[model samples]
Target: MKKVIGWSLGIYLVFGLFIAWYLFLGANTDIPAQLKGSPADPQTFMNERELLLSEEYSKIKNLLFFLSVPFEWLIYTLVLVIGISAKFRDWSKVSAKFSILQTAIYLFWLSLLVEVLSFPLSWISYNVSKTYNITVQSTQSWMKDLLIDFWVNYALMILIVGVLFWLIRRNEKRWWFHAWLLSIPFSMFLMFVQPVIIDPLYNDFFPLTNKELETKILEMADRADIPADHVFEVNMSEKTNSLNAYVTGIGSNSRIVLWDTTLQRLNENEILFIMAHEMGHYVMKHIYIGIAGYLVLTLVGLFIISKFMSFMIRKWGHIFKISSVKDIAVLPVFLLLISVLSFVSDPVSNAVSRHQEKSADLYALEMTDDNKAAVSSFQELSKAGLSQVNPPFLVKIFRYGHPTMLERITYTNEFEKSEE
Candidate 1:
């Protein structure tokens, strides 16, 4: 028994480290030369040869965005199967189940790793952009952006991970049940407080200045039964060139935030159309529905995990560097389970969100009676983000949360045609 435990422990540790190194080290090596940061002057920084290499890299990136998910899953499944098979004596019927667990761990760890390694990731991304003269500034600005990301993400994880672990340990297999229960209060608090607490950690916000824009936004809120709080602009432009706008908070405190980039890039009518779409989400009670969906799924996940808890802990427990059943570290395994559920559940989740976005679009179109403005907004988003002109169907299935640009354009054009 002692020997079995020791061997299991040894294998798990070796495997864990191998996985971590592969994810980080292997990923870094793949950074394309074109993706590396370079000087602003095309002549000074990248010669004609470098320019050609960067262009090739851009082609690869377009391929990468499509290929990344499948490539990741294949590697993930391989590692997971090997890890589980080495640990457990009988992983035949239970192999599929454990694979799911492995996938979950892969995603959570990968997500964290990506975030933790964002410094280099952003640097490479920024440098690549600079090499192509696509980026706005020097490599120093890229470092500052990376630093801000590192701190913001580190803080958010710390704030939530500790309590998340506590919840899993206290409930064990029923951790999902407890988490769902916890999420209720947490969701409420997050709605009311996250904008105040979490938002400020990364960026600053101030009341919107344009009186005409402010009045128009407020009127839309009133019609939608949303109260006026404070409309503000997030200072995201200072960090990166991406454009975004969002509605945050719940009830009386709910505020609309338009990125300064969004304001600059979009016209008043387009802005109003987007706002109306956001208002549709508020009216439909999507937030409340989301809370319910999370609770239900969590309960199901907890029930599944409860059935296999003992075998899991006994088999792969040593890799965690903990002995007691009560040790909080094992919660990572439970978290891995949630991660799997969340990933697998993306299609259903995306469908729900996509429906809400469509509904919002419909509401916006009706309210504004400006089909051209909605089309313009979509065009601006695609241009600003350099979004794929037409993403693959499989990519759409597992990844996108909203309708494709093609779909949006087609739908809006159909509406205009019907009107004509």
Candidate 2:
């Protein structure tokens, strides 16, 4: 009993570190050209460097992400199988082989369960979109797109599981070592292919044609002493009414994208604030900080994964469709560990984001004098976007990128008070 617990704990810690090491440390970490600037905006330059570095790192992380899906199914199944089996017999006496068999069954069953769960939701989402007049495509086209999405995802799942399980069965002794090494190149391939390949399948994106809006935006960028790049508007309104704006790409392709909804709804003041917030993410280097933090966490996690994976294999390795501790199937455990880590680290992520948002709000306040209009912008967001005034704490923690409507209103009012 003591041995089992020790083994599980040990496996969790070491495997976690092993996973982290490759994701956070082994990936490329280069600086992007856009992020490079003079001393005036050192933050932008630093962020660019981190973003470029992450291009290499992201490849690793994406591969690890794909690798982890089956692993999690394995973990989920193993826990259920082992927990159920332990109810009937002395856990210490159960053969590793028998435990592995039960886990395989568990994995297959869970996959079926997931397919069932996903199908209904997917159908409902499409139906809802049509009801809202958000989708113009016919039902046949939607179904075809859904089918394509499913097959793409299903293929990836099969590949990850097949490779991970095969490796684990082949090398029960040194799986983590090989898995980490292999992930580096697999990650690179994914990065090279993703933007050009994967994303285009789902949505239409084209260059922006609004010359006046583009000119105004560029003028603002110049006034702020920030780089002026191309601006693009995505045909996002074709599918959904939700509003979003982002600054994407790195070198020559670096551009800003505003959703059609955003362009249609916002006045000049509101647009300026939205721009400031997006620019804040760039100027303050949030993306770089986020990537760096991810890399650091991954390195630490991989180190832990390497140290403790064997114990996990001995106990429930069968659940993951692998018999050896060295197998990459244990990547799921690393994910669970990171999820736990993220829960613990939520406050930190939120704090940094909130501070950046506040700074951007300040920037917006300085740029515009229409305080009531600024406050009204948020009110318009709530009303049009159907955002809640106040959300539950748990929901806020999990979902919100910005403060709640109530919080924003309070902040805006306070800012106005301070001005008077």
Residue-wise C-alpha lDDT for candidate 2, range 140-202, written one tens digit per residue = 777777767766765565555556556667775565556556655665555456545666687
TM-score, candidate 1, is 0.68
Against the hidden true structure, what lDDT does model 2 obtain?
0.56
* Each prediction's TM-score versus the true structure: 0.68, 0.61
Per-residue lDDT of 255 in model 1: 72
Per-residue alpha-carbon lDDT of candidate 1 for residues 1-420, written as tens digits (9 for 90 to 100): 345555655665565555444433433322225523322122333456654544344444434343333333333333333443223323322444543344334334544544543334345556655554445555676666556666665555554555655665576555556656766677778779878876776678888777789889889888778767657888766665557887787766677788888888899998888888877777877767776776777677667655545566686655434454444334445445555666678788888877777777887787778888887787666556544433544446566778866567557645642353
Q: In model 1, what lDDT does residue 5 have?
A: 50
Residue 171 lDDT (model 2): 74
lDDT for every model? 0.60, 0.56
